[model samples]
Target: MSTKTVLITGTSSGIGLATAVAAAQSGWQVIATMRDTAKAGALLAAAEAAGVTVDVRTLDVTDPASVEACLAGLDRLDALVNNAGAGHLGTLERESVEDVRTVMEVNFFGVLHVTKAAMPLLRASKGRVLTVTSVGGVIGQPFNEAYCAAKFAVEGFMESLAPVAATAGVSVSVVEPGAVASEFVSNVGLADNALEQAGPYAPALSAYLDRTRGAFAHAQTPQDVAAQMVELLAAERPAFRVLTSDAARAFAGAKLKDLDGSAVQTLTGTWVA
Candidate 1:
């Protein structure tokens, strides 16, 4: 098989960075991009040490012009990984509309913008478009309403796009991974809107945030999640969704069961009250 050309977004850190390195090591020409190229020294060094030539560029997924220009840099792209995302921790009622919009712009619309810009190249190569979503995409979680909403939108958008892309000789797959030990948790952003005034559940919300911070104390490494992406990329007939790690698998399975059981409430009690 010919060497694949993969373009991965958010390569400055985390799973995106890991996937870029792994793909490059596997002989795929990598276009590793970060919001700010100046801060990508670690990624660049890691790729270099692995003997894989990674072309680093600046790409803020929320910018349309940037997306077009970045995609133009690549000649024949085979795969596009929509991995640029961030979390805004806060409950839905507490989060401001602007905060939710910002999350959507980066986590959801960012994927759309980058994917739209890269579709032509991917279509030409009969390549694949892989999105790094989360377990939240499949099931709702507390204190992550904004983030989960964005991911859920991604899952719906990609599911709708899959059939069309397949007919056009392109493939779309979503990788929903459980929490991984990346800077995402430590460096996560709180909903600025929620932080302002104390609401009805202010104490509970504060406690939730504190508990969440503690939970990140134990997260899987980015390498494990990246490996799943590589396998998905290499598969000939890849599924629509690839839930990475055991935690992700269990979450997805439970969500599926809940959805199916909802039709037969006599057998299964209420899930969402």
Candidate 2:
């Protein structure tokens, strides 16, 4: 049997890097992509350390041309992992419209760009489309309004397309992860100054940050999330949604089980006042 090939975006670090390495070690021909090839040294070193090979390619998911050019070179693609995403942290009042649009561009529209570019190849190969959403996608979190909105949009988009994609022999799945130990915090532009700049929202921002810090204290590792991605890709019939850890499932389950918005409000309200 021939080895399967998988293309994953944002492989410069974190879950994308871990997934790329793990998939290669598991016998898949991995195409690990990132917006900037210069940052690929870490992924390359990790792959070498694991005694596996990954073809690191430059791909900015926010750019349709880049997505097309990157995938155009690939001869085989059995799986498309839309792991590229941006993070945003700030209340709507503090967040600029431009910042919100940036998040939407990368986290929401970026997925569409890559998925649309890969659909033809995926349909021909009977491949899978797996995306890394977040627990915030299931239930909106304080200070993550814009980010969560983008994730929620992606979740809805994928869920709606899953059945239609299935008819073409494509499988669609989403992996929702809670706080995973990664560079995501910094990537999302969250910094110490965020609280200082909250203005009238300072006290609430501080409380929310405290709660967020507590949650990340027991956060899952990138490998933990990557493991779930591997399983989703390998499963004969993967589920539409797979939460990375027990905490993630429990956290997201609150909203999943509660048809009314009360449960989510009660939970998120804890970080406010």
Candidate 3:
């Protein structure tokens, strides 16, 4: 039996890095990719520390040419993990349209770019596509309008494509993770000062931040989420949607169970007022 190969995007840090290492440890050949190869030292070091080897590749998911070039030499692809994403924080009214577009470009369109680019190989190998979406994709939260919108778009797109991809022998799944200890908040520009400058939204933002901090106090680790990804890739029949933790399942379940939207509104409403 030959070892399976998986190419994961955004392997410079966080979940992407963890997934790459975990997959390698699970006996898969890992092609850990990132937008900038210069930042790959951490992933390489981690892989070495884990007593595994991973091929580091440069891939910028938002750029179609880069996506193409990254996969050009790949002969076989057992899995493609679209973990590359960007974050945006602030109310829709305060966030610039450009910033919102940027988030969509990376979080939503980036997935499409990489998935589409890798689809031919995936189809050829009957591989799997696992994406790291968020609980926000299923349930919109306060002050996360733009970010949630992009995630929601990813969820919708993947769900609609899953059946069609299945006909070609490709399995697609979205992993929704709640708060995990990662650089996501920082990457989204949600530092303390940034939240403090919310102006009229400060109080609500503060409250939301407090709640988020409390959540992170017990947040799942990136490796925990990575374990789920690895399991999905190895499953004979993977589910369409997977939440990383009980909290994530419950958080996203609110929207799934409440068709009227009142439950979500009431829950998020507390953070705003």
Candidate 4:
């Protein structure tokens, strides 16, 4: 049988890089893409060490032209992994509306652009679309208003698209990971004096940071999450939603089961309190 082809975005580092390597090692023809090709060194080095091959490409998901150009070169696509996203840490009151829009552009609209472009190829192959969302997508967190909103949007988009996509022989799933040990945290743009600039929200921001630090200190590795992701991609009938860790399951499960929304409100409220 021929090897399946999978295209993954945001492969310069973190989960995208790991998933690219893992998917390739799992016998898939991997197309690993990032906004900047200059940062491909890490992914290249890791792939070499793993004895896996990944086709590195420039695909700025936020740019529709870039998405089109990248997919235009591919003849067949069995899977599309929407892993490209940026993290922002701020409350709406402290941050300008433009900042939130920037986050949405990368995390929300970017997914739509790529998915829409890949739908034709995916439909032809009867393939799947797997998006890497977050536990925040399910449970809102303090000081993560924009980031959480974007993730929540992705979760809803995939959820609503899953049934619709299935009718076209396309599978859709969202992978929710919690506090994975990856560069994703460092990229969140937390200035050195972020708390200092929090003004009246300083104490609350400090508390949220403390809780966040604790959560990440024991975070799961990207490789661990990637292994699970590849398995789902390889499954004959994969689930619509897959949580990458026990912590993620517990964290997202609360919000999933909460009908009144009070439990989630109380729990996430404690993060900032």
Candidate 5:
């Protein structure tokens, strides 16, 4: 059996790294792209120790030139995982215009740039396109106005792209995960005075922020999310979206209906309960 080729972005840590290993272990050729090759040292070492070859390249998703350059080297591709994303935590008013723009650049526009470039390869191979979205994508969070906005854009974009891809023999799917045990939230963008300068909804937003941070503290591991990604890769007929855990499933159900039952409980239950 021939190994399928996969191009994944943001493989330095978290879901991206875990998914890279999982796909490679499942007999898929993996190309792991990160903003800094040095940051991917662990991934390279692990792939080497496992005797699975992975092509690690530097790719700044925000840069269209960089995205195009990276895609040019790949002779063929079976899957393109738009897993590169950043979180922005702050009330919309507290976050400056530039900070919001930066979040959109990395989280929304970056995904579009890479997906646009990978479309041709995917169409040619009749492959799949997956995005590591968040529960935030479905339901907006309190302090994460900017982050939620960006993910909402991803969800909307993918929903529209799925039908188009279907006609072309290409599949598009999204993985909506609640809180996952990764450095993604800690390392994402934040305003210098986010805490001091709350938006119009300071009191409510702060409480919401507390709940979100706590949920992330006890979130599921990256491996748990990666397992679902592997299943999507193997499915002959995949759905448009897959929630990573029970929390995710519940969140998706509530979010699609705009339910405001209990964000904290829904976000934390998948891992804790």
Candidate 6:
């Protein structure tokens, strides 16, 4: 049998990079992609250190042309890991609609584009689609309105697509992770004047930022989360929804059992108070 190929997006850093390296080490022909191949330094170094190799490609997930260009070059795709996403930190009134749209483009629409394009290859190979969503997708958080909304859209899409895709010989699953220690946190794409112009929501924003810092202080490592992803790839029967950590499971569980939505409401309400 030919070596199975797995294509991953946003492989320049964070979970994407870690997963790319780990998957390669596990014998998958990893197609590690990023918007800028110039940023491939760290990924290359990590792969070298792991004594593994990954095919680096440029893929801007927000662009369908790029998605097509990337996938068109691949002959066989055993799996697709939709890890390419951008984070935004702002409330609706505080930010432009365009800002939220950009968030959706990267986090939600990007997933759709890649998944839609990869369905043919995945279906042919009877492969799986694993998306790296956030715990925010399951339980909304303060000051995370835009980011959470995008992730929510993705989770809903994947959940709905799971059974449908299964009929096509393709499997769809989402992995929700809690706070992770990585450049993803620092690169939330929040504007510089955001805090200075926070004005009325300043205190709440401050509180949320502080709380976020605390959570990420003890955040899960990218490597740990990557291991779970590799495990999912190797699983003969992977679940539709998987939480990557005890913290994520516990946090997401709040909303899972909340009938009136009061549980998550009361819980997250305290973050800003």
Across residues 1-273, which tens digit of lDDT does each residue of candidate 6 receive? Answer: 889999999999999999999999999999999999999999999999999999999999999999999999988899999999877788877788998888889899999999999999999999999999999898888888889999999999999999999998888899999989889987997677777888899888888888888999999999999999999999999999989899999999889999899888899988898
Clashes of 1: 0
Q: Cα lDDT of all candidates, in order?
A: 0.84, 0.92, 0.91, 0.95, 0.85, 0.92
Query: What TM-score quantifies how close candidate 4 is to the native fold?
Result: 0.99
- Model 6 lDDT, residue 111, Cα: 93
Which stretch of 10 consecutive residues in model 3 shows the poorest summed lDDT? 188-197
**What ranges in model 5 sit over 4 Å off?**
191-193, 199-202, 258-273
What is the TM-score of candidate 3?
Answer: 0.97
Which candidate's TM-score is highest?
4
Tens digits of per-residue lDDT for model 5, 1-273: 567899999999899998999899989999999988989788888778777878899899999999999999988999999999887776555557888899899999999999999999999999999998898898766667788899999999999999999899999999999889888977865556655566565666566666767877779999999988999999999889898889789867875665555755565344322
Q: Which is the winner by lDDT between candidate 2 and candidate 3?
A: 2
For residues 1-273, write the lDDT of model 3, one tens digit per residue: 799999999999899999999999999999999999999988889999999999998899989999999899899999999999877777877768997888899999999999998999999999999999999899888888888999999999999999999999999999999988988766877766866578888888888888878888898999999998989989999999999999998888888899899988999898767
Comparing 4 with 5 on lDDT, the higher-scoring candidate is 4
RMSD (Cα, Å) of candidate 4?
0.7
Clashes of each: 0, 0, 0, 0, 0, 0
Model 1 TM-score, all chains together: 0.89
Better of 3 and 5 by lDDT: 3
Per-candidate TM-score against the hidden true structure: 0.89, 0.98, 0.97, 0.99, 0.90, 0.98
* Model 4 lDDT-worst window of ten: 86-95
**Positional deviation of residue 107's Cα in model 3 after best superposition, in angstroms:** 0.0
Q: Per-residue lDDT of 178-258 in model 1, one digit per residue for the tens?
A: 878897774556546654564776765666666655655666789988888888888899899888878678757877777
Compared with the true structure, what per-residue lDDT tens digits does model 2 show for residues 93-154? Answer: 78689989998999999999999999999998999999999988899988888999999999
Sorting all predicted structures by lDDT, with the top scorer first, yields 4, 6, 2, 3, 5, 1
Better of 1 and 5 by lDDT: 5
